[model samples]
Target: PPGFVSLVGAGPGDAGLLTRRGAERLRTADVVLYDALVDPAVLALAPSAHRFHVGKRAGRPSVSQRAIERLLVRAARAGKRVVRLKCGDPFVFGRGGEEALALAAAGVPFEVVPGVSSAVAAPALAGIPVTHRGTSAAFAVVAGHAEASYGPVLDGLAPGTLSLVVLMGVGERAGIAARLRARGWAAETPAALVLGASGELVHTWRGRLADLPGLALPPDRTHLPGTLVVGAVAALSLRSPHSTEAQPAARADARPT
Candidate 1:
């Protein structure tokens, strides 16, 4: 019998956010290669599978991308049902596309099971909608893992763009804010940092764009993955009144047009 691979999105950080299809793939996996940030509960879904950690983080040792692709091909060719579990939508900067292409080139059977991206979920979980009727109607999502990659996105961004969502950006928050300001973005533009989104330890910080560089995380969580949101909507939180998450205060100062 032949084997197959499924690139499953694990969602932001909560196991509950895993899609029905993603869950189904995990339940049938004979071998699971999961990212570093996948929640433990999600891994529990594949109890009988042989699990391997192939997650990557900034400043930490990680399995190389090429190596991971090779592993997937080898596993499938060996007649094992493989699962490449990723956090968030695999295609949303999760490198799922690269892996998929590698599998195709190798003639290995594989499929992508999309998951919720933290770019949108992080802001929503923090009570900030990326778009609102009058507040904002357009947005851009960019990866902040490298300045070379994100610098062009920031430079090409229109002055009137309403919202910007950044993933893997905490380490470069200061540089990003500086570039946005240099591009004529107002210092007082609303901004937010949502850490550990959709998880029990989630925390949100909100203030003017200028305040981003000054915002600090707990020493322990300094390297925690985060989503950075900028523009007027960052100051709005539509979470239920009973929601315990700290909501951003509505901006009293008018945002720049």
Candidate 2:
């Protein structure tokens, strides 16, 4: 009998944010191929499962997508209950669709368990709502890695018209800011970079669009996974009461309009 495969979202590096269904899948998995960003606590739940680190981090030698798909198929064909776990929502730039397509072509049965995407969740956890009654009615989530591809998209949208959320953008912060400015986005538009959102080490840097390129560089210069939030919504922050980090104190550098 062919075994089943489950593509599960790990959710922005926070084990607590993981959905019950995702956890159940992990616990029962005969083998789990998980990403680097998955919280260790979550992985602990599947102690008995054979685990493989198939994560691809920026600026690092990592597993190729093709290899990962092959591993998934091979394991499932061996009648193992395989779980391909990823950070954030599987379909949101997580390459989950690609894997699913590969499995289908290989005649493998699979299921997808959705997890909260960092695009909206990160901003919300940092107290910035992607949509507000009067401030914003629509929001755009874009990948930050390819500025050229998204240039036309950004050019068409009027500045301050809606909220913009960028995932995996910390590496291209400068280029992203320059592109937005060239596209007529206001220099004073509020922008924020949230690191480790929904996790214990959460940190936020708030400023204006023009300042984003500089603010993106944290003191440590560690290439931490982050989400970039832009627009009026970025100016609003309501830190969760449960957050260990205190409320964002006024920053002399923040050019909030």
TM-score for each of the candidates: 0.93, 0.91
**Predicted structure 2, TM vs. truth:** 0.91
Give one digit per residue, the lDDT tens place, for model 1 in 1-257.
78899999999877888999999999999999999999999999998999999988767999999999999999999999999999999999989989999999999999889998998888887778899999899999999978999999998987557799999999899999998998989998999998887765667888999999888887766656799999999888765533444332221111232
- What tens-digit string does per-residue lDDT give for candidate 2 at 1-257? 78999999988776877899999998898999999888898899799899999998767899999999999999999999999999999999999999999999999999999998999888877778899989889999988888776667777778888999989878788988998898889899999988877655568889999998776365653456789998999998764433334433222122333
Q: Cα miss at 250, model 1 (Å)?
A: 17
Among all windows of 10 consecutive residues in model 1, the one with the lowest summed lDDT is: 248-257
Candidate No. with top lDDT: 1
